[model samples]
Target: MSRVDLKVVLLGNAMVGKTSLMERYVHDSFNCNRPYQNTIGTVFAAKRVQVNDVTLIMGIWDTAGSEKYDAMTRTYYRGAKAAIVCYDITKSSTFQRAKHWVRELRSIEENCKVYLCATKKDLCDEGFVSDDPDIQNVVERYASGTQTKLFVTSSKTGENVVELFDEIIQDFISNPENLQKVEEAIVLSKKTGERYCCAI
Candidate 1:
């Protein structure tokens, strides 16, 4: 039996609802005022999705979004297949910090799939809907420059969140050749009596 593994991590400034979005997917429930728990290093949720004939086992890691834990959190980025950089639409400070996280992820993973998400849209005014020329312009510039897909989502309303994961899994399936390469490398490394980290 062949199993495909994926690790998705969320990175951003604190209080952007990263954990809330995660819980909504993993548990199908939401809490409006749950106490914020700092993920000391990395806390994870796992789910398996059936994509056609393949089963993708996704492991999502939620990182602590605190300045004091920055050094500790970077270690969790290692071996990630994809990442979602989240920011609060109402808070420009958190929005601005997303670029730094995106840059850091790109530096380590040559082709890491990066998704730029604007969280908490329910709080923002429709007058400021991101599709507006001014807003879309900003998102476009940032996404293009950073090599990421910019998307506006409301985790509270259960919007676009599922599509985000669907697209990511589709991208993985689109590359059938990579899976064979991964398996081949795994077999070769095992015979050599050692492990190679970069092959995946």
Candidate 2:
């Protein structure tokens, strides 16, 4: 089997549906009333996304969005092959939080592929969204990236979730040199202490 190891850290402010997005994508279901769970440390989920002949294993680390847990988050980003900085379309602050994560990832990941995701499209689609400029401004900031095709997603209605990972895998494969860096990072991290990062 052709396997692609893809580790993604989902980052954003609390209550922004980061976990809900993962549940929707990985399980194809969403619960609007699940009790709050503390992911201040980390939460992990794994699923296989098949793209052509490659079996891509996405080790998703659903991370805490609180600034208090920022250091913990950095330690977890050690060997991430990719990151999906998710934000809530209805909440502009979450979008800013996503931007912060992008900046942090840029420093830690030498060659990690990344995507910016806007979760909870249901809010906007259902007309319960806020009149927030963050949504429009964030989209504009990430337009080129999302266009070159490293951009936004809505896991609620299954938008771009599959395509996002597909593009990451294809992009990584297209750049063999970068893929080597990814593999080396993973191996070295494992040899040390990083078995895997949390993706709650």
Find the candidate with the highest lDDT and give its number.
1
Residues 1-200, model 1: lDDT tens digits: 22227778899988888887787676666787777776666777877777665545677889999888888888887877789899877666776788888878888876678899878777664555443335545767888886688777777777777777777777766777646655564565557775222111
How many times do residue backbones clash in model 2? 8
What are the models' TM-scores?
A: 0.80, 0.76
Candidate 1's displacement at residue 138, Å, is 1.7
lDDT of 2 at 152: 52
Candidate 1 stretches with Cα past 4 Å from truth are 1-4, 125-136, 181-200
Model 2 whole-model lDDT (C-alpha atoms): 0.69
TM-score of 2: 0.76
lDDT of 2 by residue, 1-200 (tens): 22226777777788777787777767877676668775677887887655554444677789888889988888877787777777777777777677777777777786666677777666677778565845666577575664423445566677766676667677756776755655675566657765433322
Compute the lDDT of residue 13 as modeled in candidate 2: 84
Residue pairs in collision within model 1: none
Q: Locate the minimum summed-lDDT window of 10 residues in model 1.
A: 191-200
